[model samples]
Target: MTAGRPEPVDRQLPSDEARELLALTRDLVDREVRPRSAEDEAAARFPREVFRTLGRAGLLSLPYAGEYGGGDQPYEVYLQVLEELANGWLAVGLGVSVHTLSCHALAGFGSEEQKRRWLPGMLGGEQLGAYCLSEPQSGSDAASLRTRADLDGEQYVVSGTKAWITHGGRADFYSTMARTGDEGARGISCLLVPAGSEGLSAAPPERKMGMWSSPTAQMHFDGVRVDRERLVGGEGQGFRIALAALDSGRLGIAACAIGVAQAALDLAVEYAGTRQQFGRPIADFQGLSFLLADMATRIEAGRALYLAAARRRDAGRAFTKEAAMAKLFCTDTAMRVATDAVQVLGGYGYTRDYPAERFMREAKVLQIVEGTNQIQRLVIGRHLTGR
Candidate 1:
């Protein structure tokens, strides 16, 4: 653990390898990620080299098969790794999550030849990826996307815009969804488009209040030609593939939320213990102590909820509902815990000197991304009512 930060909770690992992986993650975070996080975030600088360092360490591809250059770790272990990274820096952690999500369509639906040709390079960490599903007009209503991919002999001419794309301009490749046939979900298809393709361009990154170190931009495909071989899965299968990937991605978001909450709670507790009031530590007061207790409880609960969802996924169980519930609860908990943390630090927390205010800002986005809390509740409700 970094100096003055709370000790990480003792995690139960299934094997010695998992334990070793956690140790390595902690060392890397303390040495590289945590130290530079505040500086990079404040300047809104994307730390591409840090991502490269993580790639070199095989930390970027933990959940996929080892044969294709992934770590071959289970979801449970992979999520815990994400938690540690998020605790260090939300931008890096969420960037990793988005990259993993971008790879899902190709890894899970591509033919063997396609996987052999592309998966190796992607999972090897030499290249970065972005998922292009949301458009300017479509957010939660993903099936209403208007991006077109007209068939042209052995290629697809893609034209449209993808909004709120993480690593939009910097990614080497994009896993993009486009309308291929009639309107609605059935018309969609997935394609892999390289960054240097002619007619493909990215708009300036969005100006955001938090997670500034992660670039989010809009990508435009103006008659970009993609080879037919780049098509992932069959035509009309893109929506299903996208949904499947989201089930897993939701768990990733949940883990990241818990990590943020834990970090906020740690900061609050450390400050409470050291900052004196009326010649006594503020932590000695019953009012502030109760607040800290509630924050800790919420963090613990959020962690358990995400871990349970991850375990279900690893067990090959249907975890869509569980994933949604986890995403909703954990993100909401993070928002609350981070807000409370800001309160715990009083005036100092509101200033940029401490990270409490930053944490609060970062926590708000988690509730909105990867399918908002409202969408998650809709998913869970549908599952319960079979509607």
Candidate 2:
């Protein structure tokens, strides 16, 4: 049985406008998203209309520049919106994060002419985007990818396979990375490939552990021709762009993890307060109450960590290490919190009759995607030791 809605988080907004934005997001979630989350997810249906709704409302383009159809909001404000959306439903929220990641190369490094030509429609919300960096052979060692994009005349013909791509078959565009020169990271370059291009096709969607409605599939480019103008940044800059995009993407995952964790905690607290045991509320006991306290404490810590990293990004500071830390700690916290919530619910939590099980399944992918938690630790360690 669904517990009643939890009270809204009291947020400290940067301005009245930001407060209004969050309110709008919350209203949208309550009216349109939360009610159908479980049903849609169970049916393996992607809510494209919901994304269109977000797009039409300008939620999809919040952190980009306003001049090119973006909202120009600071990362701080944008991330809170993500967190709220995730609180209602993880798939929709993480879908938005992936869409934003797909747009990163063009927004951050595209030529002015490129932005003028493409950025508006991309950020306009009518279009969906996907990022392609991981290959079947290369997961963390992205530098060794064999996808090739060789220049011929005025165009580049691409041929390779990219695996574990989100929105693989459904996206309007794919921001792809391919090898254009010597082997390794320096040879890589980014290209924005349009959908329906000849020789470009997607394999069947992978059977996933969670987020079923959000398709993850392999993309194949069989001599898919792209104009030289479609190159983002330049040849040999793809690896750098991918890393930069992931740094910000990790922060998005961190925010989403907190959202899932907060939702689970809310469920646990509500269940404990109402479920009777020994003729008294279970929450009245110190042991169960202490668990709730720890859950809340960890959630706050995760929130503060992500927000601090977001603030650094907003200030134009290097946040690679901080973002890694947030992603690692927050996702780990989500997994622990979700599992404990299941424990708090006793046997009821294990069943799909409640949302706690779903939260646990969804929280798991947060640690794996963007970058694995192990990779995050590696990133932090490298930054710390300069080794």
Please write out the lDDT profile of model 1 over residues 153-194, one tens digit for every residue.
999999999999999999999999999989999999999999
- Give the worst 10-residue stretch by lDDT in candidate 2: 1-10
Model 1, which residues run further than 4 Å from truth? 1-6
lDDT values for all models: 0.91, 0.94
Q: What is the C-alpha RMSD of each candidate to the true structure, in Å?
A: 1.2, 0.9
Clashing pairs in 2: none
- Give the C-alpha lDDT of model 1: 0.91
TM-score of each: 0.98, 0.99
Q: List runs of model 2 lying over 4 Å from the truth.
A: 3-5
Estimate candidate 1's RMSD in Å. Answer: 1.2
Lowest summed-lDDT stretch of 10 residues in model 1?
1-10
